[model samples]
Target: MVLQGMAAFRIICVVLLAALAGASTAQRPTYRAPQHTRAPLPVGATPEDFVAFANGGMQIERDRAPDDELAEHRRLVSALDGLLPQRKGMVDAYVVSIALDSDPVFGREAREAAKVLARRYDAAGRTIVLAGSDGTGPSDLPRGSPGHLALALARIAELIDKSEDGLVLYTTSHGAPIGIIYNDADQGYGAISPNRLAAVLGALGVDRRLVIVSACYSGSFVPALANADTAILTASAGDRTSFGCQSDNDWTFYGDALINHALRKAQPLAAASAEAVALVGQWEQQGRLKPSLPQVLIGDRATAWLAQLDRRTPAATTASVGRPATALLDQR
Candidate 1:
């Protein structure tokens, strides 16, 4: 009888422990990966082929006939031919908008923001876009691959008389602590390190620069990109994630607040940044999410340059016309 009782007790204890474990697991938040639509590609395509397609660079296919390679090369050449010619004289500001992800949301936001910046800065002939194929349309170039982005910057650097021209580079994508994610869907995938970006800027020799990185953990770029002649703006701090990255949305939390709202006004970027940061905080609090804490670093030289730029360009006399503020309140 004693042995039977002891066995029964052990079984009961095991059952209780199992129940507690199950309860604990139920209390823990479950993680669901965000669903993404995978882009289509040719069968048996290699990574090299994907890279070539994404960058619009060399064509590589060992099995394919020479004619096939030539055809692809010609197509890329035609695309390159369509790019806008660089301006000859000093430009007020040259804007290069890059949407590094294949997500349509980032592409749309980047393109819209680029247009706004161009209009505000009177840089109609000086703006370039490198983005993925979102339903919206083709950018100045297809594929925001690292190679293409680097090439675009180099080309702009070579064309512009760097003495008086300022470059505004706005990049939007997903990010990790190491770097901003660069994925052209099935075409190619990579990351742009902060150091790589700094080197690009250094090689460009453009002293007056505004670098805006809209991505999670983008604050990691600030320390590397910030300098006497540069201003760096990031969507979130190194340890947090920003929201509103849905494909159906017009913009992310930071992009909407900063580029679509604050920057749309005639205020200096510094003031606009502050306003956007505050707005983001409010949105995050309302949603009961952890604070993203958008970040900005304004270099000494950029301050004077921005002041001069603001003086040259007057603020919009009219209010922004678009989705009402209420519509964007729940966006994040």
Candidate 2:
């Protein structure tokens, strides 16, 4: 009986020791969570993580198609090299480019132009792009649709909502009696009235708003967004269509001209608008379509802006309007 009791006690002690060891192993110290990854978000954390994750995924996908993606990267980087000034993280001025490629409903020219601009922004390591098709488009898109356009507006809100500096908008699309269309899917149904766009952009209270509209009768966008620091560049009057490239079958004549020719000299938005107007007028006269003349709606200090560009950046390249390098922007 004494031996039996002693054996039972020994068994109990062993079992308890094993259980304690198991518990201790299970309770090993856990690693600390990352600052940005805690249960609650940190104060002053811009949605930068979300943007970074999205962009990183996009880059991985792009790498899967190296040949095509690499060419696109080069093109966009070239555009950025020509357009944006290199600086530390925050750009004093913000340029947003939105391309509505998914809707397949309208505004092919505008969509293409958006791709160009987005690529430009991306190469500069900026997330101001509001692109939907991952940077490419289907061969054909319907005219005067607003589906993609609306999406672009929403993304712009996300990017610019908390931004304190000046913001510039560059848009290209098809236009009509009602408003601008992102594609055929949105033509009549999804059209964003100029008033609605104005309201949406105005809600952000941007210090400066510059919009470039490339479409038939794009002139209508001016009155809506016009304000103390706003400027609008329209491809044509309300009744007319703007001519664009046909080889690639793109219809964005205004974007091709503005970027390839007028902007090459690195002029301010005001001077660039003037040269674009004259060039478009000349191109329109030559075409059988009798394209509408481009117009500029300047802010109160428009000339001051033009002068400011002279002080800020080096002079634009002196290449003529019809140069071959300019051909890419006009191509399909």
Candidate 3:
């Protein structure tokens, strides 16, 4: 009787160990965009616009003298390009890069990401808009363009008017207590307060939105974007700098790893968020850098919706494209 009991316990222990091993092994290294069973954007509906805003353009050029930041920006854009949706109504993307210098690191990545997304979703008939500053201009706006904020706001309004649904907004730059830094003045730095930004985006009524802000003090934008019904993701919490960018690199650890994993087939949004947190934590531990926290704010319904999407994803790369579950989304 004693021998039988011991044997049973041994079997249970082995089973538990195997299960733990499998779970750990199956863990993905990065964030995966939530998979949804919901149908792709409607056939005739205009596709969402992907808006990318990079605040530092000159970093790329400066790096050239000593291996500029441009290389990393370029890499980032390339990765985005490959992840772009192929069809128009599915996922249309646009990119805008702004910086103190003409070819700053941020601007370059913005352009590159835009180009890559355009190629992947070219057949979808979505338009890719690329905007940037040459640095020495007024407020860093494009030559002959309107005021900085006006032009930036106008571009967003135009995109929203053209396609009301399916939009993702990405902003990467330096941030402080107020908002993002537009320029450096002898007296002080110019920044965009989160309230002002929220109002701007709210007015556009971007019903479906993904807004990513990567910078120090980025947490400030979360409340605004969330209030405006925009799904918000921030690179760091309040008063923290988002680190990781070298010449020609695709991303700092956060953005690069997130983007790479998010696009993998049938990834759940929750899973993506969890993975992002884990990756950031690991990077900090290894490098001794201050830890940066990534946060996600999604609508209540988005959670289960993302989970269902996993079922629709092709099990393998070779799997044929299947019909989207538009009806299922409607049911939800």
lDDT of each: 0.66, 0.45, 0.41
Q: Give the higher-TM-score candidate: 2 or 3.
A: 2
Alpha-carbon RMSD to native, per candidate: 13.3, 24.3, 20.0
Is candidate 2 or 3 superior in lDDT?
2
TM-score of each: 0.73, 0.55, 0.52
Residue lDDT tens for model 1, 1-332: 01133443343233223222211111113421112333233456554433333333222122435774465445444544444555455346778888877566677778877887777666676777777544444333455667667766776776666766788899997765446666554445565767678777787787678999998778888987888889999999976877665554557888888888888788888998999999888887877878999999999988876776677565663345334323435644
Model 2 error, position 21 (Å): 76
The TM-score of predicted model 1 comes to 0.73
lDDT of 2 by residue, 1-332 (tens): 01133443343233223222221111112411101111122234233332232222111111134665465455444433344433444333455554322221112334444444333323233323433221133222212224333433444444543333344566654444344533211112223446656766766555355677655656767776777666788878765666542222223567756765665565566677788777766665555457577778878754444344335444436443322322434432
Order of candidate numbers by lDDT, starting with the best: 1, 2, 3
Worst 10 residues of 3 by lDDT: 54-63
lDDT at residue 272 of model 2 (Cα atoms): 75
Decoy 3 TM-score against native: 0.52
Candidate 1 clashes between residue pairs 3 or more apart in a chain or in different chains: none
lDDT of 3 by residue, 154-201 (tens): 444455333423444555544444455442211112335566566555
- lDDT for 187 in candidate 3 is 17
lDDT of 3 at 276: 69
Clashes of each: 0, 16, 31
What CA RMSD would candidate 3 show? 20.0
